[model samples]
Target: MKIGKQDATYQLERFSKTQAEFDEHYEKDLQPIAEKLEEERQKTMSLAKEQAKKLIIPALVALAMIIFFDGFRIYVIAALAAYGAYLFKDVYEQRKKMRVKIKEQLLTALIQFLNPNFTYKPKSYVHRNQFIKSNIFKDDPNRYSGDDLIKGFVGNDDVDANGIKGTKTELSFSEIKAEKVEKYKDKNGKTQERVTTIFQGMIFVVDFNKDFEGLTTVVPKQKGLKISLPRFLSGEKGRRLEEVELEDMEFMDKFTVRTTDQIKARYILTPGFMRRLYEFATKKREVQPQNTQKPETLKEAVKVGLNVGGDQRRASQDARNVAYFSFRDGKMYFLLSTGKEHFESGLLTPINKSLVQEYYEDINKSLELVDELNLNLRIWSKE
Candidate 1:
């Protein structure tokens, strides 16, 4: 017995509707593109390491061959600087180009997966606040390549004067925006004043399973925005690098931090950092005579403050009045504390009302100005 023509038509229409629903609901089909981009990222990163290794190791080896072994002493330092700068330019630029290319390609690939014929045309560059007619480069003379260009723009005597009608900074420097502040607390509930106000930079090393997605680790759209330092910082010992502290919140007004409860609880040490420390220790330890000299460089200032030179090494986690946050489920937990001098001791997050009131008490009217058009701030420890 053959089915009726009308029945067959009805069945086909029902199947078409079901297919559309499935496409809208499930996105498993797009996984391959995401995974491919991640693979490309890994490959690109590996290539970068190879370049750095080739350049740095050979440069150091060449210097060693000329120095202690060949008595080239003082000149080795200069040679090393020149050689290091060249390799850095080549390798660093290449790695940077590759990353930008891959991320752009990844975005295109994602769009393609969503709509196969979506024909993505990537932008040449991502601008910071292009919606406004102002050029950020105009106000920040330092952002330009040369002092001459800046000097030419603002002639000798003109540079010293801030005349009202004189061509103002190329940018509308007056257009201020909202500022976000991260408040840290002691157990007794007092906020610690940062040693440095310009916490304009920080580096984060987030660890997860190799199978995990890289995008999950990135803080969203953070470039160019003013940043505040996080409450804590971490570091590696053997890299000749010192303290890896969180952003000095003193720098930015807004920030968003995330952590799962599991990651918060473990607070794992970076494996690569531990490996470097062990390797440096095991290698023929060079015992050098101690030289007492005052620091001249900015980094040296920090090293002296933290006692980071010679054999006197301290852990990044050793900084006092530090707080560590762990986000599990959805709640935040602050584990670190001020050493009996400040807080009562214990965790503090999503701070209580009493704590908030106490913090505002320290706020000075002159140091802070937050309105619709302006955001001004100048915070420091009270003497």
Candidate 2:
């Protein structure tokens, strides 16, 4: 199941459609959907503004009561809280529906334009079982949820490297949020549960239609340091896996490879593959904000800062853009730890061209990973 250089080039060419071509698709198919959603958005906001205007007088009265009438202050605050909720409940529900519409109607159409054969499911996600089976993370998450699932096939469907007609490369990914909840006692001696995020990003799994006999896990050097440490020293309760030492010092500096079979580990982590993995892990892709509406409140500003992930590298070299790779069961499982939330619409802004472009690029980047790792080369197999 291996392909030659010419076949590999052909596969790359087949999958690499220029951004201009996608822009054409966006203008033709997706633009109308966005425009229609914008119209609904305008109507919804108009009604919301009118309802919100009624709050100003009540708010002023509440403020005056707090200053002049101390006894009635609590009652006035409670009354205002209930009234505000009643006024905005419809608007909140409408905006919620609009978010769903953007994902279902607009994003779905964009995915179709990218590849008619590809399937986009907004509600479904990769199962938790697959995450556990990969064994990339040491601790299993107590809570798991995700959305924006994209599943499809790449490679030349017309002919295989051996002149057979079939596609061997299949790609699937989803935005996952996995967390671990731990219980602890506070200073008051009362037990409380603290939720810790284990992983928050995309879990990309590729079925390369090739088989491997060993499980090889590649983690960032810092994490590798912890895992590769002796059991007596680190107190690691997981399965003991031997570290695979490769000839490339640069790759070894950036990543730690642990495997069950030495020969198979070397077979997969060749010099070129190691270089690619290093570059992919070190390089940061910063996605600029698509929404034009600036944040008015401090909370909104803080949220925007986190979401855009301002252009700053981590203080530590090993801590920047951490990526994990596990090769097992004839599939390559990649866990990308991007802290920002992907493919979400801004609540304050209507759908626009820039927003649509952002979604397109975000998704297109994920699809390009197959080529980035040279997975379509099919240089080895389980035979």
Candidate 3:
């Protein structure tokens, strides 16, 4: 389904009506704390800026004087003066730490206000093992690092049309990033290394209600003859499980499927389910802009390459690269590498109703994936 501003507005209205007391509590209690933290952050930044001016102005003046004099002695003196000014680096670091602490405090308070059952950690992230298990990205521990983890439950003891009662679905999501080092010799014969991002995005894991065995990985189709040839030649050794051709030719063309068992794969990837995945992938692709414009200058080309290199690689793997699904160890993992930081607001900006509602809506979008894909449909397993 297309998630637009209407969904956000409706969710906000419903939340305002059902959770009026929570809003009142936030205004009364959390607002003061956030204001205090913002005030402290402003003061800290102002002090740092003042100190930077005091240090930098003198250094700039000394450098200018050295240039005007055009003497070796003056150059040496200016260099020493510049080095001395660097002594205040510790103070700058301290200011940065203070600002980060304040932001963490504000974020924590806001999250607590939003859902008492949920927890947020500014410095913590989903473990690398979990990422590898998810099979969303290439399993490379050396390249993975993440933070900004949030975990909680969504449903309660709510009854449904099928006479099934809702359970507390355990959900955890975090920002994850991976990088690869490109070591090459420059034209001057000097070795240079460029750290390029392999994958940068959020990963959300939901505990599936059904018990199942085997691993199923659904990945975007690999294009180009050169890339597809290696997998075709290597057979199953290339880690490409027997490709299950689906009934939907369009879906089959878009995604390459692999499964440990063909029978189970057919059971899991039903026509209805494949249609939902296809729609979600198509929606994400439609929203992404196709930049056909090329860089006008050499410098612009280099800059553009540096900025979009990782994106290019990710797109080659999956055009959208926004959402990926894998089932392993009886848990449904949604690897969403949209390259956007969700649930984060500007530190200086005051938290308003709209901002909070936006955060709620973004999270709801992730949670809704479980229902959207009908992941809890447990016909095969006796849950």
Per-model clash counts, in order, read: 14, 0, 0
Candidates 1 and 3, the one with greater TM-score: 3
Residue 224 CA displacement from its true place in model 3, Å: 9.6
Tell me the spans in candidate 3 whose CA falls farther than 4 Å from its real position. 1-33, 65-104, 113-115, 156-165, 181-194, 222-240, 282-321, 340-362, 376-382
TM-score of 1: 0.24
lDDT of 2: 0.70
Listing every candidate in turn, what is its Cα RMSD in Å to the true structure after a full C-alpha superposition? 26.1, 5.4, 8.2
Residue lDDT tens for model 2, 113-232? 766667998888989887766676767789999888889876555664667554557888888888889999999999999997777777888885566755788877774433322221
Clash total of candidate 1: 14
* Best candidate according to TM-score: 2
lDDT of each: 0.27, 0.70, 0.58
- For residue 361, what is the lDDT in candidate 1? 18
Model 3: per-residue lDDT, tens digit, 66-113?
787766656657675565447445544654565465447655665565
TM-score to true structure, per model: 0.24, 0.81, 0.65
Clashing residue pairs, candidate 3?
A: none
Q: Residue 196: error of model 3 in Å?
A: 3.9
Query: What local lDDT does model 2 show for residue 52?
Result: 70
